[model samples]
Target chain A: MSIEVENIHKQFGSFTALNDVTLSIPSGELVALLGPSGSGKTTLLRIIAGLERADSGRILFNGEDTTEHHVRERKVGFVFQHYALFKHMTVFDNVAFGLNVRPRGTRPSKSEINAKVMDLLRLVQLEGLAQRYPAQLSGGQRQRIALARALAVEPQVLLLDEPFGALDAQVRAELRRWLRKLHDEIHVTSVFVTHDQEEALEVADRIVVMNKGRIEQAGTPDLVYDHPANPFVLNFLGNVNLFHGRLNQPGADQHGADENAVSYVRSHDIEIERSPQDSTALKAEIRHIQKLGPSVRVTLAIDATGEFIEAELTRDVFKNLGLQQSEQVYVRPRQVRVFVEDYQI
Target chain B: MSAPTTTYAAKANDNHRITEPALVRWGLTVVALVFLAMFLVLPLAAVFSQAFEKGLDVYLTALKEPDTLSSIKLTLITAAVAVPLNLVFGVMAAWAIAKFTFPGKNLLITLIDLPFSVSPVISGLIFVLLFGRQGWLGPWLDAHDTKIVFAVPGIILATIFVTFPFIARELIPLMEAQGRDEEEAALVLGASGLQTFFRVTLPNIKWGIIYGVILCNARAMGEFGAVSVVSGHIRGSTNTVPLHVEILYNEYNYTAAFAVASLLAFLALITLVVKTVAEWKVRQQLGR
Candidate 1:
């Protein structure tokens, strides 16, 4: 279902957990609420699920106002970060819980419940472990069972809070792909919260970056990564070489910099050369060289400001240039996004 | 030089061992066993021996007496009423304390534990002051011809007061540790409030409830000091098993008194067994 959160606000005693925030999510799209700890992403997700009440907000699910609905009436499926599976229940019973708890008049038949539970189990590829308890399964398997259990009710929307946050790296990678495939098959309007930028970029069709109780930026993964709306998004998304210097307007004398403007560039955007060829080049000394599988990382210390900057170069280029530690080099921005000191988005 | 050094190192390792020597360990074990025999085994053996001294016929006669039979029935009835009341109170108290945050929560918890720290006799006296004929509600109760103190109701009240904290004490920590995530999950899946409680919360805390109920039942059945103060010791009517034993003992009927006491001892043993089984079940549930 399409979700519209309009001007949501939440507070806990003296701390404001969420400010006036608004977001729109289209049906059948997977979106990730990405942020660091205490960034209010999880709070927003909970508000949408009706697990928490926003101090002032209106939530609409497919044009129906759901702000007054109780959690039980919302028909929103939620998967917790800790895989809050009932320990006393078998996998099959956990999946069958929603159907079994239906009011008597509209309840499904015994055979129908059994068939549906089995179908969910098969969908999660956990049919063989239906008799096992949650504690008996691995972390990844438990989360999968939790997902299946949430989907058993055929909810209009699915909400996951850090769905793979507790798993190790390898398992997390595998589950990310599996979750993408599952979304393709079912196409339920899904929102998941995550602190891992890589996981968010890899798994979500659209990413909403949050910071300090506000939405910093929201766009497709590539858009948010390449064209961040502000410094917060740029620094949060990936590594960048921050240069504190005045910006010179196009066609302006290179030596006469505008003292008010400062700029930063991504590590890959900064180019390195053995000799200074132009007035734009800034001389620096190479301090450290790291040879990662296909790329070389060169750490440079600028002579003018004594600031260190990193430049990523391919292994072939590093070898052709004959770069060495403690060697002098000139650096210039091949492509950079410059922001003035008082810049605002 | 290497051989001699190795031997010396081994000797030092033996001297530096953390555990006591074998002889000291055996001595401590013997001491523990002696202590148990003196305190536990002796009392248990004496009860049985004294009860059977005049032979099985007298033992049977004592048990068959009308007053003894009536006392047994009274004790059972009191336990039946008191235990279930306390069980419901405990569940409600635990649910409120574990699952909700509000003002005066700590104070409420402290008040729930009030009965535990207060002496049983004092608890009975508190009720007596409240409901006794010469006490605060005495005039009103007397005018209505309703007797609470020195009656079966008084005995039940005292028993309940002593057993009030058992179930809540058992449940609060367990429920608090389990948290509200599972219940929230159930609600989000379209389960009603009652359904979430019965299907999700109850199953997770089943062992804790069983553990609490067993302890509550034991206390309700075996309480003596509190029940004695309120029961008034009226023969065949108000005297519980413990008070009945006291009356028999005062009349110099040692065998009869010990016989009745032995029945209570047997009840204690059963409670111990049930408690052990419940604890084992809790461990098994948690271990999984």
Candidate 2:
């Protein structure tokens, strides 16, 4: 199903959780709502699922207005962050719940319900544990069961709120790969909320970065990572070294040469050398050096501004240049994205 | 002087041992056993011993009396009516209080627990004031020719009033702890509101409901102070088992009185057993 959320707003007492947010999701695409805590990503997902009512908004599912639909009528599958499985139900029964609870006229036969539940359990790779209760399963297994149960309804859209948020780091990685594979097989329109940027980038076809109840950027993972729309997206996606200074060169774009312009360069973007041959090269002193696998992380303290920046170099390059701690060096930016300081808020 | 200091140090080391002395442990155990015997064991023994004092046949005969039989029937009927009514109220109240947030929620909870703090006799008296001839709503009730103040209905009302909080008190904490996530999941999965309640909410809280119902049933059957005030001691009609026991005791028929009291005690024992089982089931369901 294609979902279009138009100007959604939500508030809890004095705090505004979501503010005039709009997003459109195409059919059979997996999108990730990526943000830090209290960023309103989960709130937006819940609004789409009809679990929460937006103070003012219109939600259209495949050209049908679903804002007035009850949660039962929405036909949206929602998986909670905590794997909210029924504690008293067996895995099979939990997966069969939607089929069994269908209104009598449209309800499936008993044999069909059994076969469908078994198929779902197998799809989640939990067919052998159908008799086990949720409490008996590991956190990862319970999460898959929650997914299978959500899928049993044959929903138009699937929504998950931090689907792997509660698992350990190792399990989280495995589940991300597994979820991507599962999405490929089902090809359902799916949205999942996540705080882990790596998980979002690895699993989702598209990422919507949010902060402070607003969408900072939305694009393919590569687009959002390489071309962040603002400072928040830049800082949130990956590690960066920020240089706060005035633009010295003239005839730049009108918006690019402000006195408070901040230049952001990824760690790998800074070129380091022993001699200052280029006019753009800034003098710096090497503060620290650490061997990180095949790369050497060099922390440089620029002499002109007394500001610190990091450069990641291959070990072979470091050895060829004979670099060492407390050594003097010249640093030049290979690439940088500059933004005004006023863009923070 | 050095020898004396060394010996004194050894004695101090003995006193500073981590575990308590064996004699103190034994002494504490003996004291706890004595306390238990005095408070629990003695009273239970007294009840059973005094109950069979005359003879088995005579004790059985007392229970077989028409008035005694009628009192037992009255108690059963009261519990049958009161327990189910309160069970329904308990489920509804717990659902409303735990699953949703609304204005005046705390006030509603406090009102539900009002009977716990009020005296049982006062509970009966409140009902009496509402239904009695000289009290509020009395003239209308009189004109309608409904006899509630000194009848079976009055007894049932008093019993219900006193036991109203038992099931709800057991349920509120349990339901609140279980939370609303499962119900929401069910609803999102295309289950109707009623279906979600039955399939998700009710199953999760089944043990709590059973635990509450047993306690409610016990209180409904054994209530004395409230029932006595409202019953007016109508022989074979309004007197419950507890009231009948009081009547027999007041008349100096100690054996018969104790015999009737034993039945109430037996009912209490059954309730205790069921409560233990229910608690165990709840623990199992919670995966504790």
lDDT of each residue in B15-130, candidate 2, tens digit only: 76866888998999999999999998888778878999988998999999999999999999999999999999989998999999999999989999999999998998998899
DockQ of 1: 0.70
Candidate 1, pairs of clashing residues? none
Give the TM-score of chain B in candidate 2.
0.91
**Tens-digit lDDT track for model 2 on A245-288?**
64333332224556789888778777898797668789999999
Return the lDDT, model 2, position A174.
Answer: 98
Cα deviation at B196, candidate 1, in Å, is 1.5
- How close to the true structure is residue B140 of candidate 2, measured as C-alpha lDDT? 97
Estimate, for each residue in A15-71, the C-alpha lDDT of model 1 and write its tens digit.
888899999999999999999899999999999999899999899999899999998
In terms of docking quality, model 2 is medium
Docking model 1 quality class: medium
